[model samples]
Target: MAEAQKPDLGPDPSLLILDDDESFLRRLAKAMEKRGFAVDIAGSVADGKARVTTNPPAYAVIDLRLEDGNGLDVVEQLREARPDARIVVLTGYGAIATAVAAVKAGATDYLSKPADAGDVTNALLAMTEDMPPPPENPMSADRVRWEHIQRVYELCDRNVSETARRLNMHRRTLQRILAKRSPR
Candidate 1:
């Protein structure tokens, strides 16, 4: 009998993760690396753009907000550099407007924050035309409210008074909510 041939297993693909949250970025990078990807990490849009310019990865996970600039800019750059790259955009403050923007900028998919490595992996490797199932349990109203408030607060430079004025809420009330942990 003829000897059986072994299947070919090619080298792992490269992955880039861009996020301002250092802890989350490191954790995700380590997880992806363990799952057979050569991972690169950037904490800001500038760094991410630089990385893409130097060497575009086969896959990317980008946070919507960055310290230096919006992640969409990086997404556009990646699209230009490598049109076939699979890119996923992540955001803590998920909004319809931003989701539309991400798609327009060439993201393969958009995922809200708190997504695990498996969810990201599935998104990057998905081949079917069918859409993924909607989240079984979406964020509660209170959680959404809190998230919006927090986003505005951050945009206001973490100034309680400015955030209060922007939201038309009392400064003390804003301070109280900020002090407490986010609601579920």
Candidate 2:
């Protein structure tokens, strides 16, 4: 028998692309739109903010630096205006400090430009994918927990001490978390 059709599990309803560079914005818009997304482009922070206020998109692609202001400011504004909107930050000069700040500020993800359409699309999908059932539903808690531990570990770039510091826990405590998360 054939498998039943799944419901529309697409990225988002629409995309709001913000960048000072017109060519980049246009290309990204065209690419994303071709992939079944509704895309809107804004050339400046003010313009982007205005568009979002009028009609918010499901996701926003932001540049780290803008002609009028910094991209992080735009990220903050977008979060304030539409908390549910997923934000992806773009920067030509990727800084670890900025990446960390962006996450704390509620960015779903960050990418260093010259990113292509595929990278943006994948990140959006990953951020907005349906949540899997929690541990004990189907997947093993140990496995899931280990995955989480690994992700956090990698986020701190495999520095357990730094990861613990970032998590606001003692290094030994973070070690225990990892140990508990590990498969028996």
lDDT of 1 by residue, 1-184 (tens): 1123311113548899999999999999998877677899999898999999999998999999898989999999999999989899999987788999999999999998878887787777775486765555668889989999998999899999999999999999999999999987
The 0-to-1 C-alpha lDDT of every candidate, in the order given, reads: 0.87, 0.75
Model 2 shows how many backbone clashes? Answer: 0
Best by lDDT: 1
Per-model TM against the reference = 0.77, 0.63
| lDDT value, candidate 1, whole model | 0.87
Give lDDT tens digits, candidate 2, residues 1-184: 1123222325566788999998999999998777667788888889887887888778889888889987777778778888988788987655578799888887888886667877777666664455322223233556555655666788778999988877678999788877663564
Cα miss at 154, model 2 (Å)?
29
Q: Candidate 1, after superposition: displacement of residue 169 in Å? A: 7.6
Off by over 4 Å in 1: 1-12, 134-138, 153-179
